[model samples]
Each structure stands twice: as C-alpha cells, then as structure tokens.
Target chain A: MAGKQQQRLPREVRERQMIDAAVRVFSQVGYHTASVEEIAGAAGISKPMVYIYLGSKERLFTACIHREADRVVETVRAAVHPDEPPELGLWSGLRVFFRFVADNRDSWTVLYQHARTQGEPFAKEVRAARNRVIAEITAMVVAGTRMPGGERIVSERDAEILARIAIGAADSLSDWLLEHPDESPDSLVDRVTDLALVGVERYNTGDLPPS
Target chain B: MAGKQQQRLPREVRERQMIDAAVRVFSQVGYHTASVEEIAGAAGISKPMVYIYLGSKERLFTACIHREADRVVETVRAAVHPDEPPELGLWSGLRVFFRFVADNRDSWTVLYQHARTQGEPFAKEVRAARNRVIAEITAMVVAGTRMPGGERIVSERDAEILARIAIGAADSLSDWLLEHPDESPDSLVDRVTDLALVGVERYNTGDLPPS
Candidate 1:
C-alpha cells in the first residue's frame, strides 16, 4: 500500500515532502546529528528513495536553505508596494519579515543560523541569498530618493549604503527577535520605525546631499 | 644559533611569535589548508614545539581569535572617551575599528570572516567576542541618553536597540570597506557619521520616546 502511494505521487511532490521532513529534523537535531534514515522515516519513505530524490544529506540541507531563502525574499518583496511611499514600504516589509521569522522559527534556524555556520556551499548559498535581498532593497531606496521634478536627492552610492544599513539592522534584529520570544514583531516594527523616522525626516528636510 | 635563541626567549614571547606566524599563514591559505609546519617555519621554530605550545591546530586558531578580538575591543574602547558626547564617542570608535580592519586585514579576515564560518568552538568564540563589543556599545549608548539635568530620555531597552543597530551597521560596513579597497577608513567613517548625525539630531530634538 505504501509503495502504491509513493508511486502515485509525482517526483516533485515527493521531493517536497522529503525537504519538508528534512527541514524539521535539521532544525531539531541540527545538521551534524540529523540522519537520512530519520528524515526518510519522517517523510514516510524509504532511505533509498530519499537519496534518489535529494541525492544526499548535504544536498538536502542545501535544498532547504535555497527554498527557505526564496520564501523569505519573496515574503518581503510581496509586502512592499511600489506605489506606497518608501518608508511605508520598508515598514511593511520589515513587519512581514519579523512575522515570517516568528512563524517559521524552524525554517529560520535551519536557513540562517545553522546554514551560516556549516561552512562551504551552505555559506555560499546564504551569501547569494543576502545579495539578492540587498539588490531589491537598493532599488527601493534609489526609487525613494527621486523627486517629482526628476531630481535625485541621494546618490546611487549612498542609496546602496542605506540599503546595506537597513539589511544589516534587519539581520541583527532578527537574531534579537529570535532571542526575545516574548516580544511581538509589531512592537519591533514600531521601535525600528520610530528610529528610522528621525533619519527619514532629516532626508526630507534636504539635509542629505543631492545626487 | 636558532636553538640558542629559542632557549633565550620566554614562553610567552615564543607563543606570540607562533600566533603571529599562524595568523599570516592562516590568512593566506585559510584554516583548512594551513599546516603547523609552515607556521613553525615562519616563526623559526619546530612543529613539535608549536603543538606543545598551542596543543592542536584548533586551539591555535582559537588563540588567534582571542588575541585579535581583544585587540579590536581594546582599540575601540581606547578611542571612546567617557567624557565626550555619545555621538562623538561612537564616531571615534567606528573610525578606529575601520582603521584596525584596514591596517590588519589579515587579522580581521582570520578573526571574523573565517572564524565565523568554521563552526563549533570557533563560532562560539566569535559570538562571545561580538557580545563583549555589544555590551560596551550598550553602556556607551545608555550613558548618551542622559540629560544635563539628570533625566534619562531613552529607556534601557531602547538604548540596547540603538547599540545593536550601530554594531550591525559597523559590521556590515566593514565588509563594504574591505571590498572597496580604494575607499579609506576615514572616508567610510565620514559617510556613516553623516547618516548617524541625522538620527542623533532627532534624538537631541526630543523626538524619541522618554524612559
């Protein structure tokens, strides 16, 4: 009956099941201690089938990182509306990001904190993910700096700098968020929004240089 | 003659030489590729002596991390004066930190960029080092929030958030500094200081919440 059920499912569906189980096991026991047999058992499949689907434990972990990274980037991107003012877009994006992390603590742990320390291909994957997010943010910030007259308030370089600062602060605060489980994501957004408002106010006042 | 010099030197001096040589070799070839023989040869000592002095390759790397972490914390601490305003103190500390990374690129790479990805004891050491720096910044920020009339404007929690932002920005910017070799530490400091000033101005205007 199990074999019949497995044969009925497409390879993609089976692969997803394997990855889902892999993320749970990896997050619980961590990469070093997690076993392929355990993951296969959790997914209700044979060990050989698990290997056939994902190739190996290392590849399985990498797949988890890639999938989770995509989810995070997509979540933030979706939260931001291009028509809204840049500050509001940034605020909304941050709110969703924190919510995502809080909701998917397991995925977050596996994707970021664990994968980062695992070295090699995992670290490379994490860096690539981060660069993608930075690029998206750079675009948003650059767009925000433009005036109705087509004048640019912040230079491209400064815009990139701001994006880097925003991402760094977000990354650091995510770790803080994980540590303080009692604190809600909305409260964090409020605190950060309050802090960012000061700088945004200055930018609006022409305190920043023109590009 | 080498034997005679080895006998003449104290244990601490010999250990320092080994660590210095280890830092250079590790930075050049990375931790995995670095061999004790090369480090010993660079330090003009025997491989057996290297093991005797530092136990194993792992311990040697740990020692390098400890020494360099101390150097960074001390350099930044020395630059920050308690009597100065918090903003100036932060600026000066950041300046020295970038200078330290610029002057000792090898140390920074081995201590931060490398050790962080190596996992296990190395990652633990890196976290401990970061915590120490954060604590120092938090204290400075808390002090900065005090008014001349003995009133506090920012709450302790808010002060911690400020410190995290500052450190996260500094950490992220340091990577940017390394990537852009043409940019000087002072130039990076100037850009960051400009951004920080806007927020500081807001804080001065009583825009933030009072404790």
Candidate 2:
C-alpha cells in the first residue's frame, strides 16, 4: 500500500484525500500547531505534492473551510423543497444541518473552530461561508412570512437577525451533538426548529408578553 | 506615576492591574503568541511580579477568564430584579450581557477568543463559566413556564434548549457589536429580547402553526 503513491491518484481524488487528512490533523492539534508536512503525511502524500496541490498551510486550511462550508450550505439547499410548508422546510433544513454536523465532525471542526482561529484571511473565509448560509436562511425567512395571509413576523433587518439566530442554534446544537454522541439529529433538529419558528411567529404577532 | 513602581503597590490593586494587562496582550495576539513577559511589560510591572501575583501563565489565563466571567455574571445578577416577570428578567439579563461586551471588548476578547484557544484546563474554565450563565437562564426558564396558568410550552429539556438559544443570540450579537461599534446597546437589547422572549412564549403555548 505504501509503494502505491497517492500522488499517482487522480487530482480530484488526491485533493479530497489531502483535505480529509488536513481536517483531522487541524481539528486534533489545532491551527497553530498543525503543519503542512503533518497533513501531507497523514494524506499519505509527499510534502511537495501537498504544496503543489494546496499551495500553503493557510490555503489548505481555507480550502478545508470552503469545502465543508459548501457541503453544509449545499446540504440545506438540497434538503429544503420550495413548495413544502415553511415549518417543514425549516425542519428539513435544520435536520440536514445537524446531520451534517453529526456525521462530519472533522468538517464541522474545520468550519467552526480552526477557520476562525486563524487570522484575517481564514476568518473572513469562515464569515463568508457562514454569511452564505445565513443568506439562504434569510431569503427563506423573507419568503415564508412576506406572502399574502402570512404573518409579517420580522422586518427585513430582523429577518437577518432570525437568520443569525438559526445559525446560532445550529452552531450551539452542533456542540451538543459532539457531547451527546448517542443523540439523534432529528430530535435535536425538532428541538431547534420549534424554538426558532415559535419565536418568529410570536414576534410577527407582536406577542411580547408583559413581565 | 513612573516613580511608583507596580511592585510597590498593594496585592489587590497590583493583581487587577496585571489581569487588565493580560487581557490586552492576549487579545492583541493569539494566546500561544502571548507571553508572561509581554503581559508584565504591558502592566508596567516586573515578570516575577506577574508570576508571584498570578502563579503561572496557565493560571494567569485562567484568572483572566474567571475575573471577566465573574464581572458579567455579577453584572446581570445585580441588574436583574428578582420580582420582575420572567420575560423582563431575561430581557434585563440579555441587555446587561450586550452592555458588558460593548464596554469591555478587551475582556470579551479574552473570554470568547483567548481562553478557548488554549488547551484543556483553560477551556474547562471557560466551559464552567458559560455553564454558570446557562444554568441561570435555565432556572429562569423553568420558573417562568412551570407557573400555574403559564403555558407549559416546553419540557425541562426544552427549557435547557431555550437557555442555549438566548446564549446563541448574545454570542452572535456580540460579534455584531464589534462591527457596528456605534450601535446602542438599548436598541440591540430590545431587538434580542423581543426575538428571544417571543420565541419562548410561542414555545410555551405550543404555537406550532402550520408553516
């Protein structure tokens, strides 16, 4: 197995392998301590090959964030059917999100922990990735409430806040997923969806209960 | 001021000065790059004085987290009126939280960024502090809903989720505070409280309307 070099593999397959290995190492030891050499070694490729494929440790880290971020955003996009009830669609999207986090611990770690830990370039990459997901959520939120007979729950800006709230729930629940490894993603998804959607409805109805 | 050496100061005053300086240095550079010597220099004290006052770098970092966490918790505890309705209490708590973050950006940076970036001991310290706040929120949530005639919207476990949602909102809003430095904490507080409490109410009433 050692004699068959990973470099001999197709570029796409080889790059994926490097990213897979990179995520593991970065998550385990964290950003500052992880090295390109270690990532390449874990990928079973030469350091120069890693450099050629990914350029630098920084770029490799950014690529991992980009890939995982795309995976999460795309997962939600594919899961939500435009025609479904907004709550059901929201449930689906959130379930997809938790499942993605549950199944992809290494990926989640890269997107949340490592990416933001690095300075400006990488942190901005994470922010952009997150903003994309927030954008998707925001658009859905605007659609769900702005329709005829629908409750105008939140303002344009408030919709943006709800989008962040959803992201925050997903982010916090992702941590829960890590700790409660035996928990089902569907259950957690229901928990988060109920909390988030209910709040939006209350806000729309102006149900700010008096203390 | 130069004539009065920090070493000549009383223990209480000197310790506070050192922790204040540590927050600045740790926030400026990442934790791994921050040093006791640099912190001491920032504090206008000797290196040995820092060690004598705070024990070790690890202990010093832990102390910073502890101090900042105490400040936040105490701020909320002091600001909240025990007799106020649950929704109002939560609003007060969140408002104090955003105000704390805004006023003490350096301290917030230390708690949110630096402390977590360090390894297990430091991370555990941060976790404990956060858990304290979550515990406070959870207890309030349980009390608010468990009352007679109040909508028993959520289970004990669901109450736990509500606590986290509040935290998630505060966490994201803190980032927003960093970008929009001029924004008033009162306005942000109102925005967050409405979203959070309204959601809690909806949850209590089982207001899961058809999406």
Candidate 3:
C-alpha cells in the first residue's frame, strides 16, 4: 500500500483523470445540476487540488467539451480518405462515428445533452462541435459530386442540404441507438450510408460508376 | 359603454382570447419563464378568472402544446399523400412544415425549444407530435419502394431512419431560419426539397444515374 501510494502519477495522467471525471459528472447531472465539489469528489481528489489542476468550473466544462469534441472530430476524419469516392468515404466516416459513440456513451451524452442545455457559451461550444461534424459530412458530399466522369453535379446549396440531412439521420439514429444498445454499429452505418448515398445519387448520373 | 360593460362574452370568444394571450406570453417568456399572472394580464382578465378558465400552469402549458402541435401536424399531413411516391410526398410535406413554422414561429418555438428542454412528460408529448410527422414521412419512403424491388425495398427500420433524418433536417433548418428572419420559406424549402430528393433518388437507384 505504501509503495503504491508513493508511485505518483504524471501531470498528463492527472489532467486526463480530471477531465474523465468531469465528463462523467457532466453527463449524469448536467451542467447546472453538477457542482465543483461533486466533480472533485468524483476525481478522487481534494477540492483545492481540482481547483489548482483545472481552475474554474466553466474552464473545466469547456476542457471536457474540447477534448471530447476533438476526439469525435479526429475519429471521423481519420476514418475517411479524401482520395476515396464520397460514398465510400462517408461510409467509413459514419462507421467510425457510431463506433466512437458506442464506446463513449457518457461523453456523447455530456456533449450532446448536457452542453446544449447549459445556454449561451456552453451552447456555443456544442454548436461549434456540431458544425465541425456537419462540415466534415459536407466535404464528403462535395467530393462525391466532383468525382471524375460524374455528370449532373450537385450545386453547393444542394450539397449543403444533403449534408444537413445526412448529419440529422446520423444524430437521431445515435440517440435511438443509445436506447437500444444491442444494435451493431456496422448495421446502423450500412443503412445510413445507403440512405445518404440515395439522397445525393439523383444529383449525379444514375448509372455512373463509383470513382 | 354601459351595454359593453354589462355584456357577457360567448364561450368561443373567451377561449380565443385565452389562447391568443397564452401564445403571446409563452412565446415571449417561454413556458417556464412566463408566469400565469403575466398571461392573465395580457388576456385582460384577473388571475382567478384565468385559473378558472385554464386550470394551473401545467394545464395551461399542455393546452398550448396541444393546440400548436395539432395545427402543425394537421398542416403537414394535409400536404403529404400516403399514396404518392415518397419523394414527392416528402417534398410537399417539407413545404408545409416550413410554412407552418414560418407562419407560427412563436408557437413552434414554444413546442420545440421551451417544452423539449423541460424533460419528462412534456418531452413525451412533443415526441408524439413529432412521431406523427415522422410516420407520414416514413409512409412516403415505403410507398416509393416496389415489391419486385424487394432487396432495395424500404424496410420499416430504414423507413424510420429516413423519417428521423428528414424531420431532424427540417427542424434544425427551421430553428436556424428563425434567427435569420430574412430567409423565405419558399427558397429554403426548394433547396431542402432538392436535397431530400437527391437522397431519395440515390436510394431508388443503386448509384448515380447516367447522364
């Protein structure tokens, strides 16, 4: 016990611990319902130490949002290859997104549910994160329209609309999946990709080969 | 003056006055933010009379939600045909949806923003109203698919997914449009319809159609 106690954690390790705690707390109680003392308790640290590590509650909440938002964005980005056809790229990106959410329900809840209801600044952070996700989806749609040999290219406005629909489907499905945890990400992603591709297909030639 | 002061209002006249007053108060201060007193004052009635007419705050809120939800659902339902192909039905439905929101911004906001965030029983009411919209959209998707088109036929699961996506996109766009009041519903609906049709066309055909 004494030896274990002496093995101090690294700075990065401690910072991650605090953020993980913050995410869990925020997810459960929401922003207004959560308190600094509760977060400190959840982190297995003293209130003063938590204050020293993360500063104010607002900063701590933002830190959690940033970290989770970055993870979500990075996962989606890494899953897709820009060089690939838009349909396949979008398929991969969606698979990564569902998998990430399935693995991190707490973080998703914290980011989607708790943050949006916090009002003002917190709402803005949530919107920014949401905008990033939508933007990534939009890029994939744009790429699909610009594929070589593709005809009847989608207009920018139309592409944006498609992007919004795709994002909405993904989001609403994610919320539904949370309630029905048994559904596989592969199945969900497969259906969504099929549906999304259908939406953009009319804008391109119906018989065009995949790029 | 004596005749007007002594006259008793008809039931329909009083009910209309209460609803009009309620919409104004609820829209301005939100359901939770708006007080019964304010609503009564806006209606030019005493607090006791207001309570006698509408019961408690919860009852009043439910009344408001019921009226607005019915109006929205009825408007969209009238625009969509269960027999028509899904794409055309969805396009018509979307136009009606945007029109309803555009025409009754405050009522829509009351149902969507204020009630949705309050959680629990109220959210369920909103969800049911939302499901009606989704159900109509789902029916359209189902109608679009053919029996011989068995493999590509719209599954109930997929139809639900499509409905969710369509509804979410329309709802989010409406929310965004509320802030940018200069945007006309006709132009926005046209773009959204095009985008939705693109997806539907893609679903109908495996890939992009040849030009």
Candidate 4:
C-alpha cells in the first residue's frame, strides 16, 4: 500500500515539491552555497532523485525563477480587472504585488536579488521575466489611454513611458517594502498615492515656496 | 627621450589610462572574455606593468566601475544648480544623466549592465554606486519638499519615495533610450514631462472616461 501510494504521485506534483523546497533552501543558503542534497532532503526525496528530476542545481534554480516569476505575473494579472479604470487597475496590481513580495520574501530574494547577481543564464532568465512584466503593463496602459468617448488623449509612446514609470516605481518601492517590514503593503500604497497627489497639487499650483 | 617621457608620467595618470583602456576592453568583450594583456596594449603599457598597477583583471574591472560611477554622479550633480527649484533641478539632472549615458554608451554598459550581473565583488560595487545615487537624489527631493514659506508639504519618507521613483524611472528609461538609437535624450525627457503633464491633467479633473 505504501509503495503504491508513493508511485501514485505524478511527476508534476513531485517537481512542484522539489521547486518549493529549492526556493526556501536557495533563499536561505544562497545559490552558490546551496547543495542538491539539502534540497532533496528538504523535499523529502533522495538526492539522486533530485538530479533525475531537475537534472542539476543550475537547472533547478532556473525552474524556481521561472515558477516564481510566473506566479507574480499571474497574481498581478488576477488583481487587475479589465472592467475597472486603468489607475484603479494599477493600484490593485501594485497592492497585490507588494503583498506577494511581502508574503513570499524568500521567493522574492531568490528570484530577484539572488538570480540577478548569479550571472549568465540566471540573469538572462531574470531579464526575460522583467520584459514579460513590462510588456503586460504596457498593454494595460495602452488600453487605459482610450476614453469611453473613444478619444485617445495619450499616445502609444506616452503609454509605454507611463508603464515604465509605474513598473519602475513598483520595483523600487518593493525593495523599500522589504527593508521596512513594519509597513504593510496596503499602507505603502496609500503613502505612494498620497505623495503623488501632493506632487500633482504642488506642480499645478506653483505654490512651492522658495526654500 | 621616449623612455624618460614615459617614466615622467605620474602614477595617477598611468592608472587613469589603464582604467580608460580597461573600460573600453571590458565593455567591448565583457569581463571574462577581456584580457589584461589587451587592456595594457590599449593603454600603451606593458602587461607586466598592468598587473603591477592594477593587481589583477578583477581589480582593474573594479577601478573601471568606480571611475565610471563617479563620472556619472559628478555629471548629474554639476547639471543641477542649488538655486534652481527642485523640479527644475531634477529635470536638469535627468537631462544630463540621459546625455551622459547616451554619450558614454560603453561606460553605461560596463558600469550598469555588466557590473551588475558579474556576481559578488563587482555586484557589491554596483550596489554601492546605486546607493550613492539614491542618497543624493533623496536629499534633493527632501529639499524640494520644503517651500520658501518654510512649510513642508512632503515628509522625508515621501521625499525618499519620490527619489526612488525618479531614479527607477531614469534607470528603466535609460535602457529604452539605448534600445532606440533614433530618440534623443532631450526628446525622451520632453516625452516624459509631457506625459506627466497629461497624467496630472487627467487625474485632477477626474475626466478619465471609462472605456
């Protein structure tokens, strides 16, 4: 019965378990210091099994990056509804993104901080993920530019620029979010919104007193 | 007479020449593929002398990163005048920054794109340079928040957030600038400013029609 139960698990399920363990181990020990044995042990599988399943440590790390990047993209996409306004969609996406990072700090560290500095293949993977996110956001921004009256006030180039700003701000702020553990993701969003409002008001009114 | 002239050159001048050559080589061939012998040849020095001056290829790359980072920071700082309003100061700094990256494409590639992905000692240097830039921009934002009436509309925290946005946007847009050779730095800045103006206009009037 036990042997049958072990054999019943699918390859996909086993791979998921291995990746989940790999992320935690990689995040904690880092890429160079982490070993396949430890990862296998964390996954409750044999070392040779890990090698057979993922091929090698490098490949395993790449898998982890892809999985985490997909999860983040999906999370942000899920939070944004097409029926909503672009700004609201952006706000929702940002909130969820912060929450995702906060909730999965280990994944964030491994996927972002570690993978980026690991060089070569891993850095390429990270760049690919970033480009994917950028493309999605650019599409959203373009869609937002068209008004209910069908008037497009913003150009496609401008939409791309705004999307860059939004993504960049979100990326930078996520680092800030991780550093400031006491701040909730929602609170950080509020702070950013408030600051933008104040900046807009100041810019328009030209009321900035000379310091 | 030639030997005497070469010997008369100061250590600082020799080191500078080596670094200038190293940046060119590193940027062209990357860190691993670049050879110290090649750098020495480019600098009009012997390979043995290159080793004696810069210790190793790693240290030579480090020197290149430092010098380039310093040049960028200095260029941006010089463009921003203390008497100018914060927005104008930011605009000037951004303009100079884009120009610098546009003007020094190889340096940008070596300092930013390459140094970041080369792993440890090099990655640390890149982070340090980034932190320095962030700190300077944060100070500028904080100063901007204080009005001539001595009233502060934005908090220090908010100021830091704005600085992050500025730096992140600049960093991301610089990549876009590099990718599109036809776009001038001035044109990019104008597009960004115009987008901000339109965004501000739309946000204030709540005139965004639901699509």
Candidate of highest TM-score? 4
**Model 3 per-residue lDDT tens digits across residues A48-144:** 9889888989988988988998998999998888876565666677678889889988778877666665554666787788788878777777877
Q: Where's the lowest-lDDT run of ten residues in candidate 2 chain B?
A: B202-211
Best by DockQ: 4
**Better model by lDDT: candidate 1 vs candidate 4:** 4
> Which residue pairs come into collision in candidate 4?
A209-B148, A210-B148
Error of 3 at B5 (Å): 25
Q: Rank the candidates by TM-score, best first.
A: 4, 1, 3, 2
Cα lDDT for residue B99, model 1?
97
TM-score of chain B as predicted in candidate 4: 0.90
Per-candidate TM-scores read 0.88, 0.75, 0.77, 0.92
Tell me the RMSD of model 2 versus the true structure.
6.5
Chain A vs. true chain A, TM-score per model, equals: 0.86, 0.77, 0.75, 0.90
Clashing pairs in 2: A153-A204, A199-B199, B153-B204
Model 2 C-alpha lDDT per residue in residues A58-158, reported as the tens digit of each score: 89888888888888889999999876544456667878888888888766775576565545677788789888987887778677656577766656666
Over the stretch B106-132, how does candidate 1's per-residue lDDT look in tens digits? 778777898888788999998999889
C-alpha lDDT (0 to 100) for residue B199 of candidate 2? 50
- What C-alpha root-mean-square deviation, in Å, does candidate 1 show against the real structure? 5.2
* Local accuracy of candidate 1 as per-residue lDDT tens digits, A42-135: 9999999998878899999999999999999999999999876555566688789999999998779767998888788999999999899888
Compute the DockQ of candidate 4.
0.47
Docking class of 1: acceptable
